[model samples]
Target: MVAHEADYEYVIHKFETEYYTYDPEDDSEVKPGPNTPDINPKDVKKLPSSFIPEVKNECAQIFYRFKCPGSGLFHCILTGLVFDMTREAELLYKIIQWDESVLQPAGKMAAGPLFDIKCCEDAVRQLHFPHCVKTQEALLSDGLLSVAHFTDDAMSFIKPLKITDTHVIVDNPHLSAFGLVLDFLMGIWNKQVKGQVLLFLSPPNHAKQTQNINVLLLPRNIPMTEVSKHHQPSHFILVPSACNLIKNTTYTVHCPVANKIQPKRAEFDMEFGPNYSPTFVIRLPMNTDEVTLTIRDQTDTEVWEHEADLTDHLPFSADGRIPAEKIMVMLLDILEDLNDEEFKKFKWHLKTEVWNNISPIKENYLSKADRNDTVDLMVQTYEITGAVQVMENILKTICRNDLVKKLSTLRH
Candidate 1:
C-alpha cells in the first residue's frame, strides 16, 4: 500500500476503564471526579471494576484492571488506546487464566477472560461510542507487524502456533499440486510469510459449522507426530494458498512442479528437450477434480496463472508401458520416501527401468487402424447403446412409456 503525500501524523490521547476488570469503557487509570463524565462500560454495569494498581514504580508499564457488567469484548490486552500509547513495544502476551474449581460456583453467573490485546500499532484507531459501541481502525504500516484475530471454535488449528489474533495462515495441502503455490508466493513480495499453516476444521475454520471435510494443518510448536490430533478439519473456507490463488473455491492448479531435478546429465533425458518433463511440471493432487501444477522455470511467466487444468493430456501410466510423465510422477512420490543415496540410485535405475518397460511393450504398440477400430466400436456399440439404455430407464420409471413413444417424442 502506498502512502499519499498529504497524509498527516497526529496523536490523540483518550482514557478507558472497563467496568469489569479487562473492561474497555473505563480504561482511564485516573478516576473521573464528580465534575467529570462517566466512562461507558456498557450502561449495564453501574460502574467500572475498581482499578487495579499499576505495577509499582514501573514507569514503562501503566496497568488498569476493569470488569464489564457482563462478558466483555475488550479483547486486546491493551486496545488501540494502550498499544499506540508507546513506540517500541517491548513484548506482547496473552495468558488465558481460568480456574476450573473456582467455577461460576454453579450459581447465578460466571465470567472468564477471553483475550488480551496488549499493544496496538501506531496505525490504529479505537472509536468509543456514547452508549458503548466498540469499533477499531488499524492504520497501515510499511512492514512493521500484522495481526489477525479469529473466533474460538476455529482456534485449535492456530493455538499452538500462538499467532496473535492479527496474523493469518496460508496452507496448501497439495503443494506438489501444480507449481501454483510457488509461482504465487514468488510473483509478489507479499509481507505475509507462511508461518505455521493450519489445516482448518470448518468453512471459515473446517469449511463452516455444518459441512464435514477434514483439513489437517500442523499446529504451531507441535511435532508432526502430534499433528494427528491437531489436524483440525478446515471449513469450506477457501483462501488461496498459491500466492496467485485469488478465488478461494475455483481450482487454479496448472503449472507442474519440480518432480525430480534431472541430473545435469541423464539418458532419455525428457526434461532437457521435450520442454515437457512432467518432472519440471509441478503437479499436486489437489482434491479429486483439480490438479495444481507449478512450473519451475519461466516456462509461463514470473507468476503462476490463477486457472489451470490438465485433464485431457493427463500423464497417467499408458497401456502396458510407464509414460515418461508417469515415471516422473512415481519418482516424485518415491523421492519423498527414499533417502538421498537410495533416491539417486533409484533415479539411475529409472532410466534402466524405463528402457526395460518400453522394450518389451514396443511389439504391442497398436496400429492406427487398430486404435481407430476400437474407438469406433466403443462409440458406435457402447456409447449409442448407453443412450438407448438411459432412455429406456427413464421411460420405465418416470413415464412407463414404450420405446416407440420415446422415439416419437425425440423425433418430434
Candidate 2:
C-alpha cells in the first residue's frame, strides 16, 4: 500500500513587550487619532497590544499577533494598517504577495500591500489601509480608489467609508486578503502622480573591472526608512528630484558610459509593497566615476535626469580591505544589543567634531538617531577602518563587554 503525506510550512513570531507604545501622533500621519469619529474613546481602557512582525521570506512576508486587552485602535508600523477592535481577541495577520494580474479583469491595479488577516469573525469593526494617492483633488472625489477583497476564489471591490490624506477607512464585516486598488477605467491611467527616483550602486568587482547600478522608480509616499531597512548592502545614492510618473507607461533609462543595460524599456507599475525590486539596472566600467542618467518616456521625452558621482558612494576602502556595508552590518548588530541609555552614553563619548558631522541636521542626535542612522553616520564620517575602531572603543567604554567581543570577532 502506498502512503500519502503532506508537508506544511509555519512561521513563528515572538514578542517581548507586554503592550507596545501607542503614540497619539506620529510623523507618518498614517494612524487615525482618538478624536477621529471612527474610534470611540470609551473603548480604549488600555492601548491595544501591537507588535512589529519579523519578515519570514524573501518576498517580505511578515507574521504577527495582536493581543487585544479589550477594544481599541491598533496600528501596524510596517504596512500602515490600522484595526478597530470591537472585543477582546487575539488576531494573527500577515502581509502576503499576490498575483496582481488577477485584477486586470476588474480593470484595476494595486496601489498598496495586500494583507491576510485571521481572527474571530466580526472581531474587527473597521480596517484602515494606507494609500499612495498624493492628493484627493480628482481620484478620491471621482470615486476611483477602493479596496479589493479576495474571498472564496472571487474578488470584490469595496468603497471606503472615509478617505483621509494617508489612509482609506473601510468596514470589516469579513476578514480576508485585502488591498488598495485604483480603477484605470475611471481615467486614472491618464493622470500623472508624484513619484521618486532612487539609485543604488553595488560594490565593484575589481577583478573584472565592472560594476552594477540599480535604479528604482517609486511613489513619493513610500517611506525612505522602510526602503533603507530592506536594502542594506547596496550603497544608496542621494540624488533627490521631483518626479511625475504615469501608471503602466513604458520608460527607458539611457546612460552613455554604461557597458550594458537590460530590458531597454520598463513599465511603470505602482508598487507599494513589502518587496521593492529595481526598475532598471545599468552596468558600467569599474573606473567610471561619474555618469549621466536619463529617464525618457515612450514618446522619447526626458522626464527625469541626474548626474551622480560614484566616488563618495563607493562601498570600499582605499586599500580595499573591507567593504563599508560589511562594517555597517557589524556595527548595526552590535548596537542592537545596547539599551537606549547605553546608546546615549556611547554617543556622548564620541569626539565633538565626529558627533557634529554625524548629526548635522539635529542638535540632539540621540533623540532622532536610530541604529541604522548611527551606523550610517559613523561610516560616512570615518571610512570603513576608522568607523570600526571608533565603534570598538565606544563599546568598550560603555561597559558592553559582550558587544565589544562580538565586534572584535566580526572585525577579524
Candidate 3:
C-alpha cells in the first residue's frame, strides 16, 4: 500500500495467468488470464488466516487465468466473499447513518458473494475477521459477524474516504461526441442508493463557459440514471465570480462546517480519468467550457451584448452588500427592453410574455380596417413570423451564452 501511494503509476509486475474478470466498468466479462496464482477448493485451508478471505475464495479455481491490463507492473488483489441475509441487512443500516465528517472504523475485512444460510448462528462462525486485540471476542460477539459485507473504502493515516457506489468518466481523447461520459455514468446509478452524482470535470476540446452538468434520479430498480430534463432541477451552484480582473480570484463561501463563522475551504481542479460520482465540491468552469460559438441572428430581430462593468452588476456590488429590495429590480432588468442599436449587434428575443402581460390591445383606438388588417397582416406574413420563431428558438440554446455563438446561430 505504501509503495502504491508513493508511485501509483508503477507498472504491475505480477504475471497474470488463468483467471477471469467480471468487470464492473463495462457489463462485459473479460477473458481469463494466464500464469496467475492458483487458489481452489483444495487449497483453501492452506491459505494464511492473515490473508484477505478474497484470496482464499476467489482465486484461480473461480477466476482462472484473470488478467490485468497494461504491462507486468501492477499487482491488484480482487477478492469476493459469501455472506448470509443477516449480514446484508446489518451492513445496509450502518452505511445510511454514516458520518460524513469522520472516517468509519470497521475491522479491515471485506465479505463477498452473499447467500442464504442454514442457520444464522453457524453463518456467523464461518465469517472471516480482521486482526484485532479483541477480535476473538468480536467474532464470538454478534455485531462483527452480524454484518455480511464490510466496506473499508480505504483507510489512511490521515483522513480517508471509503466509497462503494461509483460512476466512472473515462477521459477519452479521441472521442468526439461529448455526452458519452454522462451516458456511461448513467449506466451505474440506481434506486438502491439514491446517491448524488456530481461530475467534477468536463470532456476536453468541448468549451462551455458555464458548467453544464446534469444530475438525475434512477427510477426504482432501473439501473440507468437518465438525464432528468423535465422534472429535475439543474441549479448553478454559484461562486463569487468576476471577469478578467487578473489576480488569483477567491470568494468567501458561507461555510456551515465547524461553526466558527468561517471554515477554511478547499479547491480541486479536475485531474485525469473519471469525473462522475458522489462528491463534496465540484469544480466550476470545467474544461468542456472550451467551445466555439457561431452566432445565428434573425433578419427582423437585432441583438447586442455588453461586458457590463462588474462594478455595476447588481446582487454583487463594488462594495459587497446585496440589498433585500434589489432582487426584483435586478430580475426586471433582465426582462427590460433594451432596443439600443448597439444591442442589435449582439442577440435578441421577441419579449412576447413581457409584451402580452403588460397590456391588452386597445381595440377602441383601432379603425375597423386597421383592426381586421392587423390580424390579416400577421396571417399573410406567416413565413416572417416562422423565421422569427425559429430565431427565438435558436437563441434559447445554451451555447448562446457565448457571444461568438450567439452571433452565428442568429446569423443566416
Candidate 4:
C-alpha cells in the first residue's frame, strides 16, 4: 500500500511540475476580430404576438419578434429588454457578438449584451436595458451608466433618460446595435461590483486522461439563460455565493493539483456580452474527484474559493446514455412541430400528476411556459432522474409517437 501511494504522489508531482510550470511557448495573445454582419430579416420567421415576443433559438442564437397592434409596452421573455412602441409595427431583435476594443479609447466597458434590433416602422420611442447592479440607485445618481449605440460607420454613447432598479431607460430615435456601457472616467474602474464565477466541465473523453474545466468571471446581472444558450454541452457548476469583483482588475486562478492552467491571469472587465468566452481553462486528471479552486486579485488577495466535486460534473456518457444537451436539442426539434393548441396539450401532459413522482414540471411554470422554458425544465428533469425513458413515455401518452421514436433513437 505504501509503495503504491508513493508512486501515485510521484506521478502527481511530475505532472504538476511538467505541465503547470509557465512555458514561454504557451503564451499567445488572441486579438478580437471585426463584428459579423447582422442576420438578414428575410431569413427569420416572425412570430406575431401582441404582448409577449415570440422567442426562438437557432444554433445557440436567440431571436425575438413581437407584433404591435397599437402603442403599448412589450417585454422580451428571454432577455429582460423592454420596448415602448407607438402605432402598429413588427419588431425583431437578436443579441449579436461585437468586438468591444473600440470602447477602450473612450474608457468605457460593456455592461450588457449588444442587441441588433430591426423594426418594420419607426414606432419604438423608448428602450429599456436590464442591469444587474445591486447598488443601481447609487450608480444612477452618480451618472456612471450610459448606452452604446452603434451604426454602420460610427459608435456613440447616449445618456439614459431614467434608471430603474432593474433597467436603464433611454430614448430610441432609431434602430441599430444598442447595449449598455459603464464609463471608467466616472471612477467605476476600481469599484467592487456584483460578480459571478461560472464553472463548466467539458465533456469527458475516455481516451484522454485530462479534461478542461472552463471558468467565466462575469457581472452577476448577465442572465444565466443567455450563457446556457451558448454552453449546452458542458456541465454547469452552480456556485452557492456571489463574489464582489473590481472592474479592470487582474485576477489569477490557482489549483494546486491541476495539470495545467491557461492564460495565467485574466482581467475582470465589465464585459456582459453576446459571447461569453471562458476567462481561464484548468486542465486536471480525469480521475480527480475533487479540487480546490481559488481566485486572487493582482495583489494576491484571495477573492473567491470553492471546493468543487467532480463526480456529478464529469459529463461522461460511456454507458450508452445520450447527453442532456443532445436530448434537449432533439426535444426542441420535436416540440417545434407542435402548433399552438398542440403545444398547449404537451404542457398539460407535462403537468400531470403521473410525472410528479419522477420530475414534475411545476404548475406555475407550465401556466405560461414557452417552448424554450419547457425544454429547459425537461433537461433539468433528465439530469435529476437520469430517466430518458420517462420523457419517452410522456411523449407516448400525448400521442406524439413521432417524437417518442426520435427520443428512443436518441437514447440508443
Clashing residue pairs, candidate 2? none
Span of 10 residues, lowest total lDDT, candidate 3: 9-18
lDDT, candidate 1, 171-220, per-residue tens? 21111100001112222222222212212222221232222223221112
Q: Which TM-score value belongs to model 2?
A: 0.56
The stretch of ten residues in a row with the least summed lDDT in candidate 2 is 7-16
- Mind giving the per-residue lDDT tens digits that candidate 3 earns over 1-412? 1011111111011001101211236323111234212322123221211101111112111111222221111111112111112221211100012231232233322111211222223212122211111122212222222222212453222110111111111111121111101111222111111111222122222353433322211111111111111112232111111111101112122212212212122222111111123212322343332221111112212111112111111122222112212322222232232233323321222222122112211232112212122222111122122222333343354234343333222212
Error of 3 at 8 (Å): 29
Off by over 4 Å in 1: 1-88, 106-211, 214-236, 239-412
lDDT of 4 at 97: 82
Q: Which stretches of model 3 miss by more than 4 angstroms? A: 1-42, 45-119, 129-208, 212-280, 286-412
| TM-score, structure 4 vs. true | 0.56
Model 4 alpha-carbon miss at residue 27, Å:
49
TM-score of each: 0.18, 0.56, 0.17, 0.56
